[model samples]
Target: MLVLLPPSETKAPGGDGDPLDLAALSWPELTDVRAGLVEALVELAGDLPAARAALGLSPTQDDEVARNAELLGAPTMPALARYTGVLYDALDVRSLTRAQRARADRRLAVGSALFGVVRATDRIPAYRLSAGSALPGRPTLRALWRPTLGPLLAAVDELVVDLRSSAYAALAPVPGAVTLDVLCERPDGTRVVVSHSNKAHKGRVARLLATTTGEPGDVVRLRALLRRAGFHVEHPGGTALTLVVPADWATR
Candidate 1:
């Protein structure tokens, strides 16, 4: 089973690993595109104003642009450790056992704007780029990624659980991939889509899937697995699973 996660806007800076190496990444087919994007980012970084505007960053976020400037030479860290936010915080990767860590390295992959997709253990440097960012002379990220990334993900044989946000998911959609939705159940019996804490829930789900001994081969089994793991999972038909959390719990 493969679980596709969205990349976080905030990343942990500084790493002990060597500098970026495109060839060492999992999908060698993406090496050219990755190199091109990295070069584009480096060039863009030279023009701080343009880079800030293109990346939707504020004046104070110039450090983020600096990170992009050093993309090629910056130290690297595993993709899982490089990403930080509510999602990664909830995943709590540091607490996992060796066996569970190995499983996570094998089953988890992150959707990246610059690298396309990387395995959990793939060593990557700190860089700032969002799915919606439009570099000066490059095609829209969706246009650049879909043609290649779409086919690659579609060709994967294992069951894919896609937990990417709409923006990243639009870059390269996985056909027949099972998706998840987080809902908050109010006391009035009405359910509202979770927004603020959605990632945390997905992170927990990913953690459960990563550490479990079972591999769900399809949406049905996936739903069963989540349900067995104590999640309030609902299959409202189709390939999407809805996980309902109490309104009070969601607010926290």
Candidate 2:
């Protein structure tokens, strides 16, 4: 789905490899995602069945959040509903009538676009860190790098801008990349890291490595190397990537 054949201008001067799979989602899928969001919003707003009736949704709307989250791989439908409710309240979304959710959904849609879930599978052997503790920095932050970094980084940066610095990662198409750039939140020093991944596959690939961490305000070197790796990487719009960091990871 990511690659839908090359773009119109492959040999042309401005041509950048094939177009990514950022096409408009199928209507049904969009509807499913939207419906899930609406239901979650209504439920969070108060009244469950009334929200469903108001939205013209079916009983299944009750399960839509979980269902949609599972399909979209988002946190959870209820979680989304809860977060979205928060966004709505913050932005005064509840009072906005029909015209508003339509407009606001655009931003949510962009958040969806920013995510590249396929990349998760690539980190099967990734280092796991607890929620409270730091994700490792500096010396311990040199393990996450992949060849796909060249093709995926820029998109991710754009996504970070859209998601406002929310959590994001990329898994190479082939998962054969030599390194990884993990975004973590440490207490004392660094906030993100770029290290060598695929160590378990070392016997098969031989380019085993470690990791590196840095501040969101300064990851240009890492971004450039990832681009060189053939990944269409982009530094997240400062606001976007920074916005996504967890409470502990955020500027403290």
Per-residue CA lDDT of candidate 1, range 15-46, in tens?
A: 99999999999989888888989999999999
* TM-scores, each model vs. reference: 0.98, 0.22
Give the Å error, residue 103, model 2: 2.2
Backbone clash pairs for candidate 1 read: none
Model 2, global lDDT: 0.26
lDDT tens digits, residue span 44-160, model 2: 325545444433446764554223222322222111122222222233334445554443333222122112221201111111111111121211111222232324433433222
Model 2 lDDT at residue 160: 25
Clashes of 1: 0
Q: Which portions of model 2 miss their true places by more than 4 Å?
A: 1-88, 109-160, 166-252
Ten residues in sequence with the least summed lDDT for candidate 2: 3-12
